[model samples]
Target chain A: MQVCKKCLLNDNMPSVRINEDGLCNLCSTQYESRGIVNNNEEEISSLIKANREEKYQIILAYSGGKDSTYSLKMIKERYDASILAVTFDNGFLSDTCLKNIRTVTDNLDVDSIIIKYPAKKIIRAFKYIEDGKFFPRQSMERASAICNMCIMLIKNLIYYEAIIRRIPIICFGWTPGQVMTSKPLIKLNYTMVLKGFENIKNIITSRFGARYEKYFLDDAFMRENEANMPYLYYPFVKNNYKEDSVIEEIKEIGWIPPQNTDGNSSNCLLNSYANQCHVSKFGYHPYAFEISNLIREGYLTREEGLTKIGNVANPCSYKMICEQFEKITG
Target chain B: MNIQAVNEKLKEFFENNFLYGESFDDINGDESLIDKGYVDSIGIISLVAFIENAIGIKVYDSEIVPENFDSINSIYAYLKKKMNTQDKAV
Candidate 1:
């Protein structure tokens, strides 16, 4: 399939088109708007200082992924706030990922907490997914469909932990490319985000039984009070750094690639499967959404986006995913 | 018998639960919903749950589709019709 000349977008993607001059949806938006924007670093720095002046203990949603690692490092180096690095082991991380978590946490002098789901429940969840008999209707056409479920659970855990520890600022290392950083940090609206999860919970409850509801849902009162803070990606929205350079700079902070993983994944093996399934079903890798958004925002060019696509997912991973699915289902 | 009441209930449910963009105030009851940009396909399941929660109605898995949510008027009209049928069946 022909890729968009301007961004990582492919011609076959649903509802996306490249104009004759080769501008993708994202780049075209920027072109029409006259230019892109980069926020003032001094402003961001002053905001961080003002926010952290209370000596709040920062709860970092550490995924053991490179992005979160960079986030942890930034929060530690910049704010010098006491940081807690927490990872939710979804029962499928490669052995190397666990080792990297240890290495980075120790090097950064940050306290680490690792939470793992019960093996039986995770296996049952995996089997349910593999059976091809049950799937959440919302999962289609997205990369990380299964990972999304895991993330939802992890998010609830973080919120609960934040409340219990009285940690006011809950930080996750989401990059600008992942979710737009139009607004960096805002107080949580449990009602709005919670409502989105309700129907998805019904599907999960029906398939895996209602026993899992508490893990996937958060208390309303806590969400309304605690702050939701995200850092690394929004800065990129303003400065528009090359991913390679950011990855390189962070490597000096003792970041290392996990063994048996490719450039597309510096952290999770499950990501490869999710991306492959999304591409097979949707005719394009799911990363196209983020890449297209970045390109539209003038942070990256069409060629740059397409080049990065090769690094995010590999089709070959599908063979292993199919084998694993069959094994679980059997 | 509760069709109009059901419509009012669903409208209230949408406002209370659903978050729309800045243009939400411009939403008219009769316009095409997806065309008018109220919610995407992803919002449909949530809408189903909202109807179930508000109207105390049950919609089968097969009945979930664009036709049921094409417009606010359509959603209002459908809930009214379905709930009436349901009242009779009961």
Candidate 2:
């Protein structure tokens, strides 16, 4: 239960040690060695320029969240690159988020697609996480149940779209902490490591008696396109703009925060329940590491990060999540 | 490099970077580091980076299969083969 004085991470976090000065081992380690940097303007511009000649230059994993909305606006207006905005409708999107997605994409005049998965499949994935069978202990340090599976689906979809469209870049609205454990900008070859997820996939298949293979990029697809997989970019990770300023700017493009999401999410209604499930199992919100990363990077104050991870799930949201899962699973 | 040198270097890297300074007394040369809970997918990515930087070899996607990365022995063997191939090509 001991929290780091410097950030929101606690002793429960894997591989963490608090020092006499109250700084966690992660903070004390050679900061420069960490390679955590904000928006690399040169890299972003060069990537766009390098892919300028390609049709549909970028495939953005848009979620109608505030960060993603901002990213869509930037890719459209600032870079003026042709983009395909892809949203995976995980059957948990709030009404407000759907409207926001429509409004913002309409305003931006970008091509967009929504791929909705079966609610039963999503619930099955959740069942595995609820039972602590999906995510590795190290992964729990950064994200929760639904968030992890949702991200995997989104990334796979983006890779699928990018490969089919021959797009050279896949951009995300990921914050720094999300990319902290790995390089922010990675070659598509990194997908080779996804073989590791097969263990979790096997577990899900055994329990659900269903092959959710479509949710992941097949090895054949990766092998056929291995020579030309798109680069995965996290543009918002090191942006100089703070969250408040970005929210204010995106408002001009008709982006509005959802009423039903948890304190950490702007789009997914399932986040509140996922947070509750995560805390019940792990004794901490999965977002604690992400919020703490923001604090360490000076994007948020310590007090603000603490408040963001505080219990924000309401009874109505919890009841809705349970009812939806039961209806789908039954 | 010799296998002894490669083993020593990899043990040092894993202990320093991934193990949080914990020694590898329980780790076997042939056991799967990932299946044993010592590494995860993200850790594999970092290990790739470390190999590319520290060992000065690019790990192609085709080379990332489990046969090349499941354990200290596998990684050392992979690295030795890569270096030998590079030397011959040079």
Candidate 3:
């Protein structure tokens, strides 16, 4: 339970070493001196501006969360870019998030697409992860069970939509902590590495049948046309926007807080359950590194990050998650 | 650079950076670092960075495939080939 003095990382966190000064190795290691650039608003704005003249300028992977809602609003109002917002309904969305999605997109006057996976499919995927049949064991040190699979599916669908529509920019609401430090605007060629998930795809195909391939891998299209892929952009990661201000700005666009989700998440009901499972099995919160990154970058305070991740799952949500898991596994 | 020097350098980099200063003796040079739970996707990224900086070679997106990066032996072989190609071009 011993936490880092400088960041929210605890002693239980994998790959962390606490020094005599009570600072985690990540804090003491002079990561900034490694030559990774911090948030550069000018570079991000220029990238957005350069893409603005293109047709269907941005395809935002919108999750109806506060960060994405703010991103959607920013793309429309700030850059005046034509945007297509796509939401992947993973069968665990809060009602408020759904309402927020409809209200915000309607207000923004942007085209929106919702790709809803069947509840059974999502449950089955989770079951595989839960049974340790999916994902690399080392990955558990970084990501949650639901997140590893869910993000893969979302990214694939987004890439597919962007390629088909010839959208030049694929914007995500990823924070600085979520992305590699070298760049915020990644070339499409590099983003196509998701296609290399051969082991995960094989597992899904064997366990859940080949139907999962449609969602997880767009092999035919990717093979024939991956060269024509769009650039991946992370606006939130590049700009120094305060979280409170982002919430407030999105509130003007009809975004509301959900009652069912954990403090760290605003859209998905499954996040708390996922956090619970991650902590139970791995002895650390899956989001600890992400939250710690936020703290290190001064985006969030150490105490706030700790409080946000600590004991996020409630009994009611836990019961609901168990029931859903049972129905899907059966 | 000689293969022995390159191999020694790679071992040092992986041990110092990825393994958190742990000795590389426990890991096999030919075994899959990923399958052995020694590296993940993020670890691959860091390893790529280390190669570019420490080995003085640039890894392209196409070279990120498992054939080139799944194991210490694979990485050393890929580096040797790339270096030879660079030398020939010069």
Candidate 4:
């Protein structure tokens, strides 16, 4: 029950060390000056402006979520950059999220790719994810297993789309809360990515069979196009993350608050169920780790962090999620 | 901290937290965890964050390559180098 005074991360997480000063080890590290690189805004701008080859300068891994909607607006308004917005419809997106995707993309003149698989296959993949132990244990601190599965798949599909198209920048509207890294802009290391991809390949292919294997990059494709694959950019992580202002700003465009999700998410209807399952097994809210970063970065107060993670008791939306899922899987 | 103790802790952490129904008892220390499918790209991100948080070392973004982090032996060697550098600075 002990939460850090400096940030809202509780003692239940093994990585948290709430010291005598009442600051958690994560926050307390600030005094030691680790000198991590944060925000390559100028570099990102220069990179984007300099790259004139691709028709769409950045292929955004859009989730039709609040963050991506706002990022689309910013990238368009600021750089006047051409963008290809991509969404992986996991069959669990709230009705509001779907509508927001249409409204925002239509108004912004942003082209889109909605990657959707057969509903039965997608649901079966999710069922495997929900069975637990599908991903790294540390990722459980940040998101539920189901959410992690969705994110991993979405990222892969986006990467595949980007590489095939030879897009220069694979951008994600990841929140500062979500991506706590100091470096927002990252050059892709093909070797490291390939090495890391083995785990994902093993988990998904082993469970989903060869049907899902085509989602990954193949050696033949890499032999021809590996040199042209794009790097990734996270604009939200590097910029000031004022959620209140962003919500207001994005509201002017087309986004409306999703009705079916829990407080921590506005895109996925499965969020409440995922949060409950994650907390039931892990002894802490899944969003607590990610939300704690928001508090530390001044985007949210400790009370707000506590409130966000405190929603584990939200009426079980598992039935509601299943209703929508069954409608499709049938 | 003793090098063996640090290695043990690192291995213990990976096994307890990163395994997926596979037994780590037989995983060779020199084998690439990535190649063996014990760790993946995203898992390595978490591992790096854990190393930074638990070991209190500022891992340069460049140091996140497989050369320094792909195996238990490689990670221990990397950590020893980093700690030595810190100590010399002190």
**Maximum-DockQ candidate:** 3
What are the lDDT scores of the predictions, listed in order? 0.58, 0.74, 0.73, 0.73
Candidate 3, after superposition: displacement of residue A274 in Å? 0.8
Q: Considering summed lDDT, which 10 consecutive residues are worst modelled in model 4 chain A?
A: A30-39
**Model 4 lDDT at residue B21:** 34
In model 2, where do residues sit more than 4 Å from their true spots? A34-54, A181-184, A190-193, A209-211, B1-23, B45-90
For all the predictions, what are the DockQ values? Answer: 0.03, 0.20, 0.21, 0.19
Tens digits of per-residue lDDT, candidate 1, B13-74, equal: 45432322123345787775544444533356446545554445655533444566667767
Which lDDT tens digits does candidate 3 get at residues A188-307?
353235534656777788877878788764566677776776776777755785788998888888889888788778998888788888888867888887887788888889778888
**Candidate 2 lDDT over residue span A1-330, tens digit each:** 778898888777665677888887666652333334334456656877887888788899999999899988877876757889999998888899999999999999998899998777778777666645556666666787677777777877888889888887788887765654334566635445456666666666676665677777777778777777777777775465477898899999888887767888898888888888888877777898788778887788998888888855756777899888877666
lDDT at position B80, candidate 4: 95
* lDDT of residue A291 for candidate 4: 85
Q: Give TM-scores for every candidate, taking all chains together and pairing residue i with residue i.
A: 0.67, 0.83, 0.82, 0.81
**lDDT of candidate model 3 versus the reference:** 0.73
Stronger candidate by lDDT (1 vs 4):
4
Give a tens-digit lDDT track for model 1, residues A1-330. Answer: 666665676556544556788755435543122122233344445545655744446778888777778777776887646677789887656677788789888889998899988756765665455322233322332234565566667777786776666665567776555554333333434543454455556666788886877667544654565354222223233345466666786678677766545345677766666666555656676667666666665667777776767765544554665576666656
